[model samples]
Target: MTPTSEAELAELISAATTPFAIRGGGTRVLNADDGPILDTTGMSGISLYEPGALTVVAGSGTPVQEIANALKAENQRLAFEPPNLNDALGTSGESTIGGVAASNASGPRRIAVGACRDFMLGVRFVDGAGNIVKNGGRVMKNVTGYDLVKLMSSAHGTLGVLSEVSLKVLPNVEFQVSLRLADLSAQQAIDAMSSALGSPFEVSGAARDADGSVLLRFEGFEASVRYRAESLMKNLAAFGAIEQIEDQETCEALWSDIRDARAFAKGQGDLWRISVKPSDAPEFLEQVQPSKTLLDWGGGLIWAELPSGTDIRAKMTVAGHATLMRAGTDNFAKLGRFHPEPTPLAKISADLRARFDPKGLFNPGLMGDLS
Candidate 1:
């Protein structure tokens, strides 16, 4: 059904009466579990742009690159830099703004700034009951009730079909500098990263590549960045030889790949995103012994691509949080923290599911069965 308006979208949803997966440019759909699909690409355009207020409202299906480019023209940017999943997944499609919110795709900047949910101000969507519901608002400080806009960040179209979104934007920084440390052991690198985080220096991004080389980024006013980079280099000298990457084009290209986990994409396997304590990284790596691994979020997020057909879930259980990023089958990774618990909050989530989609008409197994 081609929905020209929210009302039409609601009508279409109500009439379907079957489990349907929402599609935006269909970028990551192939990796998604199978179900009836509802394409939202037809519902695309920007509705409002308040540069002074640092907010923009756009159709749910609007391309992410389009929004990024538009924001760049005004010297503003999405605080939560959404990852380029297309490049990481080795596929081509326009990743929609809605998809980024739905997936809660975040990059290195997430460590300092925020996640997609934090910047989300409001959303207009068609709920499972065939009703067009609006939550939050265009203004940043309008917190009058439950923040449903934030709740929908990583919902992946399971709760409702997004129609429009309003988000907070930040002023673009003038300069960026990357400090590279070579030949440090994984544990040593993570130690240095943690030390930098505690310092007065403002480090925006920190990660260890497959070669065990650590990269740190500082972004802000040119003078501040320069001062911070020099201080950080002096403090982290014990780790290894340090080199400053000052080339603008090269810096952008390098961070762009790091943001999306491009290096681990080539070797095909069951990809797992393991979130462990920064201090537990060395022990976690010893357990998995993955063929390739990239540590990000200062060792909190460990990107590991295991050998094909490996049972990564068992290794992931050692860590606190784990998600099977790419899998050949439906079960994905057996998560430790995300599993259903016998608690009041679990009951509330169950009730909300029943209210929204009694028949489970949206992405039934994506977040595990409601029942």
Candidate 2:
């Protein structure tokens, strides 16, 4: 089912008797729900973009590349730096802005700026009852009341199907540099990343890749970036001899690889996205022993690639949550896509779903039982 306009989408939802597998670009693989596929890509195009104001409003189905091209032309960008997971998910589809928001897919820069939700200024969506709801506004300060703008960001279309989005953007950095510390153990890498992030020099990216290399990124005007990179290099000298990636193309490729989890893209395993306290990551790594790993957000986000059907939750001793980001038939049913929440949080989630989707129609059972 493809609706080309917001009104058509609302009308379709109003008359829908069966559940819908709401899809934006079909890039994000979730538990398959039994229903007609409602594709948002038909409602595509940028509505408004004010470069001077650093804001872009676009239809939910607008391709992310389109927005990026528009922003690049203006020397601005989405501050959160959302990742394109098509390769990682093994799905060949255009990545849409709505999918990015629904999944709250922020990348390494999240450590410095924030998540996709933070840059969201407003949203226009269709509720489960087919009501067209608008929340927040184009500017940053317009947020208030229930903060539905944020609530819808990561709702995965359970509460509402996003029709349009307004985002606050930032100016592109003048220069960027990356410092690499080779062969650091998990704990040492975490310690080095923590120290770099804690320093006054604005570290935008901190990640440990599969091959045991820790990379830290800094960006700004050329002089400021150079100063911070040199100072951080000296501070991290005790860890290992630092390798500097100063070429702009090389640095961008390195971070892009990290952002998309390209390391585990073609591997024969289920990919999991785990979140834990940065301080707990070393211990967590020791416990799970994933076949391959990529640490992002200074180890707060762990991308673990393990053999098929491995119940990673059973091996977890640290306090964290895991989402099976990419799954095969082996463990998709048994493990479920999202990690189970604690009792209190589970109840709160259920209540919210019930309030917004009383009929249990939108993406049923995607996030667990909505009843």
Candidate 3:
């Protein structure tokens, strides 16, 4: 079922008796239980764009690439740098901005700028009860009352079906430079990334490839980028000799591959995205010893690929959460996709769900058993 307007979407949900599997672009594959599918692609378009003000408001179904092109024309961009995971996930569809917010997706730049929720100024969504709700606004200061905007950002379409979204943007940089340190061990890679991030070089991207190479990215005006790159090289000399990648196309392709974790795109094994303190990452890797791993966010975000049916959570001593990003259908049902929330947080989640979805008609079991 595809609704072209918010009113039509509300009416459909209001009249529905069964659960709905809300889909936006269908890029992030999930093990959705059987139910009627509600695709949001029909409800897409840019409603408002103010380049000077650095804001863009679009329908929930607007394609992210479309938004990117528009912002690029204005010398602006979605600073959060949301990743397009279609290739990695093996899904075929446009990557909608709504899906980005729904999953709270962010890329390598998240370490410096922020996550998707930080740039989200406002949102319009239809609650599971079929009521249209609005929060925040086109401008940043327009926030009032409870901050449901943040809540809805990562609710995974369980709290509501996003209809529209307002986001803050940043100007594009004039130049970009990448520094690489080759053949570092896991700890060495983490240390090198940490040292580079700690330096005053404005390291926008810090990641370690599965092949033990650490990449550091800095972007700004040409002069500023050059100055910072030189400073980073000198400051990080203790780690190793830094190789500079100054070619624009080459640097961009490197970051894009890192942003999407393209290494595990077609490999065998279930993919797990682990979030841990940057300092604890080396320990976590030592314990899990996954077949493949990619480190991002200065080692705070770890992507590991393990053999199927391996419970990563059980082998953990580090204080972090591991989310199952790729797995078989039955495994999703048996092992779950998200980490179990603590009792208190679970209660709060249950209360929110009860309030927003009184009929429990939205995507059921999408976030695992919240009963």
lDDT of candidate 2 at residue 182, scale 0 to 100: 90
Each model's lDDT comes to 0.80, 0.90, 0.89
Give the TM-scores of the predictions, in the order they appear: 0.93, 0.98, 0.98
The residue pairs in collision within model 3 are none
Per-residue lDDT tens digits for candidate 1, residues 84-127, read 76655556789888888877888888889988888888888888
**Arrange candidates by lDDT, highest first: which order?**
2, 3, 1
| Model 2 regions lying over 4 Å from their true place | 30-34
Cα lDDT tens digits, model 3, 146-191, are: 3788898899899999999999999997899999999998889888
Can you give the lDDT of residue 233 in candidate 2?
91
Question: How big is the positional error of residue 89 in model 3, measured in Å on the Cα after superposition?
Answer: 1.3
Range of the 10 consecutive residues with the lowest summed lDDT in candidate 1: 332-341
Where is model 1 more than 4 Å wrong at Cα?
A: 29-33, 317-319, 330-348
Model 3 residue 109 lDDT score: 98
lDDT of 1: 0.80
Find the number of clashing residue pairs for candidate 1: 0
- Model 3 global lDDT (CA atoms, 0 to 1): 0.89
What are the per-residue Cα lDDT tens digits for candidate 2 across 1-371?
99999999999988988887888888877554447788999889999999988889999999998999999999999888888888888888888999898888899999999999999988899888889999888877666543788889888888988999999999998899999999999999999999999999999999999999999999999999999999999898899799988999999999999999889887788999999999999999999899999999999999998888998998999888999988875477889888888888989999999988877788887788875
Clashes of each: 0, 0, 0
